[model samples]
Target: MAESKFEQSLENGAHQKIKSLVGKWKGTSKTWFEKDILADDSSSEADISSILDGRFISYDYTSSLNGKPLSGKMIIGFDIPYQKFTFSWIDSFHMGTQIMQATGNATEKGFSILGSWGNPEYGDQLFGWRTELEIISENEIIFSAYNIMPGEEETKAIETIYKRI
Candidate 1:
């Protein structure tokens, strides 16, 4: 029998790279609600681990927003058939009662995924959210997110730089 693509990935492909993210990380998070305006800057911690036999990476992180406690969990995986990265995220502060599902291809340094959300009260208008995860070195990583309004440019919403702990 021939080795499956996913199996190949697990052995020496994207999954191998994903495994590097499994560990404890401590860092600082910066958030912005308005363009060019910093909102909250606080310490954050993340625990990442391989789940389901290294098929996916689970990221659970805790931080603060405006002096209030906030946390989020994310599941990231590579889709073999689609050849893209997929992620589902839910956070106490930004997500409220919703989960964001995103998909994208790999970037030069890492992966970038995009998702969207809208409120019914807002009359079906949706906004885009893009998240990027970049591994700078064996001990350092940078995670960032952008907010995209309809018919407008994307703006940086949050950025977190983490170091292995």
Candidate 2:
């Protein structure tokens, strides 16, 4: 079948939005295990790139957590067929082998994705997960994660502030 006009164009708005993230960023991540107690804090570096002819944004980052190597990769794409923003994330940590994914609309500042991280083989999840990616500017971004347990308050588990290098 002939490719749709969107697939044929590399200059779409979503593509451009993804393009804006292509750069190196220096940042720090704060992981909280308790309400106010200090937990793991680490410096991080992110190298984002526009790949697959601007159809997707590749995000790769590395940091040390508890003196062990921690790294992750995320692919951000706009699904033309479904008209939704698509994303998949994998990491050396955070569930180990679960390829958490979510689809949502793009916000003015950035995007919000909601998915679950649990036993990959099981159906229901122990908790729900929400990921927010907000752009502060061309120079900065915020990545935050929240955990939702039934009949409990939404708890913020992780947040990383990235500034372009």
Candidate 3:
């Protein structure tokens, strides 16, 4: 597909935004959903405390799901000019990548990224989603995840509150 001039501008801005996310952030999160019963049970903690390195533009996220270990490395990058920010991840369970674009700049508090990813385990189905990051400070932030699937009732997948530790 042909690239639009506006897209180029956004891409450039997104790169800088991604750069901002390159730092140590710590927080906690909660999962709330209607159909996704397993995630909403709240039996275990969904807290996150991560350290992001700018040199590699990568992050080490540590958390737990149902009381099991959850950790991954997402190397953040952009395509060009800043149209979108790609999050390439690899961890104990999945070895895949997801990209989220700049929906807009930080609002009252932080920023939001809107994008979708494919879940091969879920029959390679495309899952539309968004992640909101609220910067509490230079060392702490909050991450919230939501599902924005069209035609389907909106659902909350997971929310991770992060802090720099």
What does candidate 1's lDDT look like per residue over 1-165, in tens digits? 999887899998888788888999999999999999999999999999999988899999999998999999999999888989999999998998999999998998789999998888777889999999998997999999999998999999999999999
TM-score of each: 0.97, 0.86, 0.57
lDDT of 3 by residue, 65-107 (tens): 5666667665545544453445544655333344333343444
Overall lDDT per candidate, in order of appearance: 0.94, 0.83, 0.53
Q: Which 10 residues in a row give candidate 3 its minimum summed lDDT?
A: 41-50
Task: Count clashing residue pairs per candidate.
Answer: 0, 0, 17
Model 1 alpha-carbon drift over 4 Å, by segment = none
| Native-to-model Cα distance after best TM-score fit, residue 99 in candidate 1, in Å | 1.0
Instruction: In model 3, state the lDDT of residue 84.
Output: 46
Candidate 1 accuracy as TM-score:
0.97
| TM-score, predicted candidate 2 vs. hidden true structure | 0.86
Give residue 50's lDDT in candidate 3 (0 to 100).
23
lDDT of 1 at 50: 99
